[model samples]
Target: MIDKILNIKELNYASSLNGDNLKQKIEDLFERPAISFFGNFTSQTEFAAYDKLSVISWYVPNFKRKSAYLKGEILKSGKGTLIKLNIRPNTMLSVASIVSVLVGIIILIAAGSSTRFLIVGSFFILVGILYYSFGIFSRNRLRTNFEKTLDLHKV
Candidate 1:
């Protein structure tokens, strides 16, 4: 039992090293504001197929934190990527809304007298509205978080 535990611990350490190395490489390649870390944490009681799996999950936060630092460095270096990550969700929401609107129009034309078609169309409209609203909310949240981070660093 003790041997098994030791092996698991070693595996976890090795897995963490791999993640750290990968993050370091990304930082080196991006060279500043182009990177941001993302982390995931699990309850202590959670068990995975292997120790390595658990380590990767735990290491995500560290990677994200480092990425945030990288972002700052890039901002200071003035060599950061022009691309922004937060816009994708909004773009996706817009596309989905357009598609939903088109589908609703098609259903209205095809159904003629069927109430079910109306119901379906309304459902799609509702979904599209919710998607757009959620996207806006997400954008606001990201902005708020970024502001908070900047404030913290300022102090």
Candidate 2:
């Protein structure tokens, strides 16, 4: 699958809780639909984006949207419940950003020798790099939060 090839961020945890208890813990960690910044989930395992605004790290979400959505799978094992989590990026958002940057570059090329177009194109390239860099930088933070919330021990 693409997930395996892309090296998506995955966390596997062995929880002592039974299936229902594990599910409940995950459910409890999510904010109410009205309070959530992202869409509500009806799936058995998927949760909302990591949108808990913290005074200590208030700006994390802005750059994090590219890679903060949560997807998970719960499997019953003989020893315990297994929680498989994927910290997936917002695909649509990522694609849109790329498309926009490409458009900006194209416009700059079409504008020929204009200094203004060059400046704007450079800004677009800088913004794109910053956006991707910050997303990658925050992925570990999101993983840590999931571990703390679920009391996960890495497997």
Candidate 3:
């Protein structure tokens, strides 16, 4: 069995076993994610897995309460097994985030009228960027950590 990361955000490769067997092995490797503390915050960092699918999520320390997660699916490809992972953010939060960034741009454009708008707009823009960035970072970090923990790259 050979595993490879197609990109920083996705991991997949070829396996000789069926999807059920492969998924079980992954579950065994991680066992269960531990709860860790950062300052006064106690957050859960873990994934839920089944025979053909897995969903991974963890807490982000950002001021805004946002959750990040990834979904993986196993499929049969040719004579081998193929596993793919991706983030689907078509939710309200994702939409609001994009709107925030656009609103920030509008505020900046209206800034010539008042410095107050500039300040507010800047704040919005910063928050929007952080929200978006944290979402991406969280998803990738979890996937990377999983691969590293299991030494999948070399497998």
Candidate 4:
């Protein structure tokens, strides 16, 4: 589900394609079909992010990890173009992880004579931390990727 639709003002696609073609190209570039399309000069996508702002949406291969869905639109303006995007995070997994850690803590507190409970709780805590760390790692990776995708200004 889309959570936040970002507004990108005065964007320059530097392309000559008509509105429909340009919208299709944008969706194709994102690899996700858009959910809606507007007037002769407007279109909307259910999932798309600027190559930079979408850093947090990157996916990692793990059962604990989750996917983020996005939605937005592109419209022709006076000189450039206007873009509106909604980025949503699959926070259920993270919330579940937090719950797991809490469960683990409770198990430990009540696991007086059971090593199994202690181990299980510890495992939950470790997994929670690891999954959370992966999110951070992916976001940092996005930053680097974004920079590489853009030409650096000459000093």
Best by TM-score: 2
lDDT of 2 at 79: 90
Model 1, which residues run further than 4 Å from truth?
1-91, 152-155
Instruction: Give the clashing residue pairs of candidate 4, or none.
Output: 4-86, 4-87, 5-85, 5-86, 6-85, 46-70, 71-86
Cα lDDT tens digits for candidate 1, 1-155: 53221111111111112333433433343333432323221222121110111112344443321111111111111332211121112344445666777787788778788999988877877776775665455444443443343222221
Best by lDDT: 2
Cα lDDT for residue 130, candidate 2? 57
Please provide the root mean square deviation of candidate 3 (C-alpha atoms, Å): 9.9
Number of clashes found in candidate 4: 7
Model 2 lDDT-worst window of ten: 50-59
TM-score of predicted structure 2:
0.60
Per-candidate TM-scores read 0.41, 0.60, 0.59, 0.45
Error of 3 at 47 (Å): 9.4
TM-score winner between candidates 2 and 3: 2
Q: Write the per-residue lDDT of candidate 2 for residues 79-143, one digit (tens) a residue.
A: 98888877754453344446657867886887799998888887776666555554454555567
Cα lDDT for residue 7, candidate 1 = 17
